[model samples]
Target: MAKRSFVWGLGRYLILATAGLLAFVAVVLVALRFVNPPTSAFMVAHQLSADDARVRQNWVALEDISRWMPRAVVASEDQRFLAHWGVDVNAIQAALDEYRSGGGLRGASTITQQTAKNLFLWDGRSLFRKSLEALLAVAIDASWSKQRIMEVYLNIAEFGRGIYGVEAASQAFFGISASQLSPQQAARLAAVLPSPKKMSAADPTPYLWQRVRWIQQQMAPLDGF
Candidate 1:
C-alpha cells in the first residue's frame, strides 16, 4: 500500500511540475513579444565554452539595418517568409520526401523556427528540442509581426565564431556598419549563414561565391520589402 501510494504521489508531482513548466514557458513567450531578448542559449553556451573566446554582437533595429539584408536573408534562407505563419509545409514535405528517397537530409526550418530555436532552445537535432521549437515558433508567429520576426532573426543569428548579428558580422568581415552594408556584402553574409564557422564572408571560396551570386540574383525578385 505504501509503495502504491508513493507511486501515485510521484505521478501527481510530475504532472504538477510539467504544468508549471509549461505555464512558465508560455509567459516568457508572451513577454518576448514586447521585449528584445538580451542573449540566447547559443550565446550563453558559446561564452561559457573554454575553447571559444567571447564574440561580438550588437543589436541594431530593423530600421537601422540595411534594407538589402532582409531581402538577402529571405532569398537565402526562407523564400516564403512573408507567407508562412511559422512552419513551411511545402519545404517540410520536400525534405521528408528527400529523406525517404535516401537522399541526404535537407533542412526545412523556416526563419521563425530558427529564431525560436536560437532564442529559447539549445543546439541539437533531438525530437524534444524540435518539438519545443515548433511550439515556440507558433507562439512567436502568433504574437509578433513578420518585420519583428525578421528583425530578431537578423540580430540573433550567429554569423561566425564569436560573431553574431548583421552589425557585428559587417564589422568583423568588412569593417563596416550593418547600415552601410552593400547588396553584394549582404548577400555574402547571408551565404555564410549555413556554416558560418567554416565559411568566410570576408574571403569567400568558389562555392561560397557561387551561393553569394545566387542569393544576389534572388534579391531582385524578392524586392519590395
Candidate 2:
C-alpha cells in the first residue's frame, strides 16, 4: 500500500510539473507579444566571414540592416518581401516544383521564414524542418515586421569563414566599413552568400564575378525604401 501511495504521489508531481512547464511557455509567448526578446545569436562562417562581425548581438530595426548591407539581397532573395506576411505562395509553389523535379536543393524561403529559421532554429533542410520553419515563420510574422525580419536575416546569415553580418562581411572582404561599401562591393558580398568560403570579396572567383554583376544590375531596380 505504501509503494502504491508513493507511485500516486509521483504521478501527481509529474502532472503538476508538466502543467507548470506549459504555463511557463504560455507566459513566454504572451510576453513576446508585448515585448521584444533580446536576441542572442550564433555567427555561422559565411555571415561572420570576417573577425569584426564575429560576435552576435540583438538586431533591432530596418535602418540598421539597410545601412550595413546592400539592398540587392532584397531583390535577389525575396522581391515580394514587402508584399508577403510570412510566406509567398507563388515562390513556395516554384520551389516545390523544382524539388519534385529534383532540379536543385531549394530556393523558396521567404524573408520572414529565413529570419525565423536562421535566427532561432537549426540549419537542417528537411520535411520536419520545413514544417517547423513554416510554423515559426507565422509566429515571426505575427511577432515582428518585414523590416525587423530583414534586419535579423542580414545580421545572422552565414556570409563567410567565421564572418557574420553586413558589418563583418564588408570589413572582412573589402577592409571598409559596411556603410562605406559601394554598390559593387555590396554586390560582391551578396554574390558569395551562397558559398562564402569558396568565394572571396577580396578576390572573387570567376563565377562570383559574374554573379556580382548580376547582383549589381538587380540593385539598380530595387526600391529599398
Number of the top TM-score candidate: 1
What's the CA error at residue 151 for candidate 1, in Å?
A: 1.1
What alpha-carbon RMSD in Å does predicted model 2 have with respect to the real structure?
Answer: 5.2
Error of 2 at 43 (Å): 3.2
Clash totals, every prediction: 0, 15
Candidate with the greatest lDDT versus the true structure = 1
TM for candidate 2 is 0.73
List model 2 lDDT by residue over 1-225, tens digit each: 999999999999999998997577457545655554454234443244445554533333446444425377766577788887788889989887988897885768887777767665666778898887787787677666566666667766657766667777766777765667777877777777767668777888788788888877777867755
User: Could you tell me every candidate's TM-score relative to the true structure?
Assistant: 0.93, 0.73
- Candidate 2's C-alpha runs over 4 A off are 1-41, 44-70, 99-102
User: What lDDT is reached at residue 49 by model 1?
Assistant: 83
